[model samples]
Target chain A: MDFLELDAVTKEYPNRSGPPARVMDQVSLSVRQGEFMAVLGPSGCGKSTLLQMAAGLLPVSDGTVRIAGRRIIAPPPEAVYVFQQYTRSLLPWRNVRDNVGFAIEHRLGRRRAREVAEAQLDQVGLEGFGDHFPWQLSGGMQQRVAIARALAAEPAMLLMDEPFSAVDALTRLDLQALILEIWARRRLTVLLVTHDVDEAITLADRIAVLTRRPARMAEMVEVGLPRPRDAVATREAPQFLALRRRLLDRLLLRHDG
Target chain B: MTAERLLRPLPGLCVLALILGGLEAAVDAGLIRRALLPPPSAIAPVLWDMLASGAVLPPLLATLRLVFAGFFIGSAIGVAAGLAMGWFPPVFRLLEPVVELLRPIPKAALVPALMLFLGIGETMKITSVALAVLFPVLVNTLQGVRGVDRVMLDAARTHGWGRAHTLLHLVLPAALPFILAGMRISLGLALVLAVLAEMLAGQGGLGFLILDMQRSFLVRQMYAWLVILAVLGLALNALFLLVERRALHWQPALRP
Candidate 1:
């Protein structure tokens, strides 16, 4: 059974003067428990809009998003969104530990929240950097804090929108490795949005290629690369190379042709 | 560390001393009449006596009380209204016209009107000072609130933060720097209004004494009260800066 499902979801942004601009045509997708699904598309392909709607952050102009067989209109307690701009999402005024704790503080209060936050920080390899503010941390570390914040909420589903796209290539690899390890340990169903073909091939259980603007799901390709994957070896796999080429062809056709 | 802080002002003090010494020399040489511009040497003794005897407390306290009261009242209302206006469209729409109508009118010009209603007492003076402090704070807070990053608000929503949680933890801290800036600008205006209101009131505080002494031909005493007012202004500004830095320790511009 699908743990999270986006059923024929369509998004249209209503403009002030003109008619509503359609962002995504009816796109259906579903993720089983403990599955990692990556939505691969070109830039400005409404990938973020799809993820946001699934997270219940943006309302779908058409269709329903169901989590655990229940339709969700607002952000569900079982899911959390990890934003791309980690710098903006992590409150600058708050230290790293406090920012992580922000997710659960209202429920657990300060002292308890800090203990939980520390454990989450440890899980994300940010153990000794708790008291440091977001502005003091590197971009990669800040994103780890953002992930730690989502983990502290103890969400069953993580909706990530190009979370590591801003970090350096080396840092992005480290983050990808970190997230995969965490995802396995926690049994989380993750829907990661990205434009990078290699990222989709390396991380996802299945890749959903989206066509550009008012995007529709062009194809869903199953990533058959063996589990217990490492970032270094995953890219060079014959299967990984094939999937990457196929996605690139599908994504680049409208641009070059 | 403390020594460096203490020594930092030495240069400005030296400049002040040089100017004072020049004035004293001119007075002693009889190039300037003593009645018109008394030497700093002559004014110093009166200042010392008033401070030593605690005679400066009454008027000093009166003016300070007015400034503090007006400042707090005005700031509290300004921040509250600014948040409401920024967060809610109806509040902004309803209050915009009235606020705009009142905000642009020079606050000092309202003194006669305040006197007409509140009489020539503390009430009139405080109302005048508070009016001066209100608009800048309100407008700045509104700007700050509106300027809050869209991503931050979106993050709050996705993280399961409720309206009050978002307002207190997110909205207020985000707008604090702007609110404090408005308060800083309004602090100087508050003092201006306090002094002007006191002068117009003509019955209490240092402003009255300064004007009264000059009219009474007590030149050194007038200058003495004037020094007290100057010190008062300097002290208030320094105190505000210290508090502002403490409150916004996270801000880059405010870092030491």
Candidate 2:
């Protein structure tokens, strides 16, 4: 059995006046342990909704989602979501340490939780910044705090929804590298949703392209690139360029069609 | 440190002081009869005497006790009910019509009927104040709970926070500012109703003291009690603002 499985999953949202609309049309996918998968699609492609459903934030309208053979009927603490908006993700009222500590404290005892949270903060290169509030930190630093919070939970899976889209170009590259390092060190199974093709190309071991609204998987591409990849070298590789061109052509053709 | 900040409140305070001084001068000069509008100086001595004799302490305490009791009880009920209504649409639909029916009827107007059932005592006064305090708190709390961001709710749910945990941790914390604001308004209304109930249906409190002085033709005494009442109201409002400031220190303060 796959570590995480979505078997013929469908999701529908009801409107008060109109007919119920299907957002996911019998979609299915499987994620193995320690796999880094990125889902790339255009805006309003219901990719985020799919992530929400997989994380158990929304119930499947039909079919089933299973994590390690257990069906996901409601949110399970085993998997955590890293939201797109870093500013709104962390509770403003809580300082960085407390925000990270909150998840640990809820999951474990207070003293052990604080220890774990402090350690996770250090791991994220935010050791002394724990006492500072989210607003006091720069956008990149805030997203780091959010990442630390997710890591503190020791979740089996990390569901990211364009977590770097809100930051500057310089910061986005830095964060992408940071995520790669963390994923390698922790051996975390990551499922990231992004619109940036470069981001998908740089980080993902496998990329799943999603179609427009009422999203369905269009294509799945495997990155044959080796581990510990350099950003500059990977972008310069002939294989990388060829893959990017092919994906762009596919996206444009779909758009025109 | 800021020049604009230093200048902002100066003109308003100066104008208020000037108007008050002018009113005192006009009354002292007999442009307005002392019987109708006694000068501040005349009322000051009467207030000193009342305070010295401890004549005002008991009633002030009575009013304070009633206001606090009513405020806590009303706020508790309102917040719980509001959360229920906000989280569950069926509960909102079931309770909304009844609340709307009771809300518009002036809570003060029920004083007579309450007095008839509960008598012209502390019970009637507390009930009146509680009733008056309930609506603003209920409405504000409901609005606050409803206004919580959908994304936050989703975040909480995705984190495996159950319904009770979400209410205690996410919903209550997110809605705190609105709940506090509503309670502040309700506190003022609670005081108003307490005084009104005492004046119309009872024989004690600042309101009754004023009525007593008026009956005895002690206009200065009446004015003195009125000043004390104003001071008390101002002090209570300041206390509430202070508590609100402490509780919501995370929020940036707005300049007026």
Candidate 3:
């Protein structure tokens, strides 16, 4: 049985003065326990809509999204979605630690929540930013704070929607490495949606390429890179280069068509 | 930047001083009618006497009590009602007509009716002030609540936070800047209504005192009451600003 499942999901957005537009059609995917799966597609291809359904942030027009044998009708307690727009996601009214702690605050109480937030902030290499507000931090650091916030809930799965697309190239690489390190450490079921082929190749166990809207799975490419891989070494490897080239050719060919 | 910051308010303060100085000079030089606009120097002595004789305390206390009571009462009702209406469409639909109908009727127009029902007493005075404060707070709150970022609400939902929890922890905090702004506007309106209530139908208040002093040809005492009224308004607004600064310290400073 898959740890996370999306079975024949479809989404239709009703227009006030026009026919309802179907954004995505009959999408199905499954992720095993402790696997990193990346959904790669061009921008505006319903990648975010798919992730939103799995996280129960948006309702599916048809079919079920399930995690751990349970259908997700509402946002499940055991999974958290890390949004790509970190600036919008993190509360400006809260300092870094408080924003991270906000999710679990009610359950743990303030003191313990602060402690949990501190621990997560440390994990994200933001040990001294507990007092700093979101506006005070750089974009990359703010995203790290968001990642820490997602971790604070101690979710079994992380649904990430192009989490690094907004950052600079070097920061994106660094964040990709961070995600890999965290997944390695925690053995989490991670479903990442992105447009970057190299990011999927570098971090994902398998990459699911989605076609343009109405999006559907075009191909599922398995990554054969070795585990505990160094970022520079992995990218330089023959297998990595070959996979990257193949995915790029496929994506570019689709774009041209 | 540091020098610019220090110099920013200097021009405004200097202008204010010059205006006051000019008014005093005009009165001293007998260039302007003193009855219409009393010199700042003469008014200070009369205000001191009123304070020393302790005749000012009762009216000051009366005005403060009414203003504070009305402000708090109106704010409580406005915030709760606004939030409820904003979050739920049904609540808004049910109550929106009543709000729309009542909101536009000049609050002063309602005073005679309120006076007839409640009598010329504290209840009437408080209710008048409360009515004046209510609309602005409610409107601002609704705007604030509706303006909450969609993403923040989604974030809360994903955490399994219920409606009540979300309202308190997420919605209220997001709506705070709007709420405070509304409250500040209501503060000024509240003071106006308080004084107006006294003027219209009052047994005793600062408004009554000012009128009585003027009628008796005690010009300096009348001017003194005006000064007190101005100072009171300034003090309340300053206090409200302090509260706003403390509450919204988390938000980054916005440039005008």
Q: Best candidate per lDDT, number?
A: 1
Model 1 chain B — which ten-residue stretch has the worst lDDT? Answer: B247-256
Residue-wise lDDT of candidate 1 within A1-257, one digit each (tens)?
Answer: 79999889999988999999988999999999889999998898899999999988888999999999999899999999999999888898899999999999988898999999999999999999999988788999999999999999999999999999999999999999998999989989999999988888889999888888889888999998999999878998888888778778878896563
TM-score of chain B of 3: 0.91
Worst 10 residues of 2 chain B by lDDT: B247-256
By lDDT, rank the candidates, best first: 1, 3, 2
lDDT of 2 by residue, A24-78 (tens): 7877888888988899888788888888888988889998998878999887777
Residue A1 Cα positional deviation in candidate 3, in Å, after optimal superposition:
2.8
The pairs that clash in candidate 1 are none
- Candidate 2 Cα errors over 4 Å, as ranges: A15-19, A109-111, A231-233, B2-8, B28-30, B51-55, B88-90, B252-256
TM-score of 1: 0.93
The residue pairs that clash in candidate 3, if any, are: none
**Model 2: colliding residue pairs:** none
Evaluate residue A158 in candidate 3 and report its C-alpha lDDT on the 0 to 100 scale: 95
Per-prediction TM-score: 0.93, 0.93, 0.94
What is the C-alpha lDDT profile of model 3 across B153-205, one tens digit per residue?
88888777789888988899999999999999999999988988998897788
Residue B30 error, candidate 3, Å = 6.8
Which of the two, 2 or 3, has more TM-score?
3
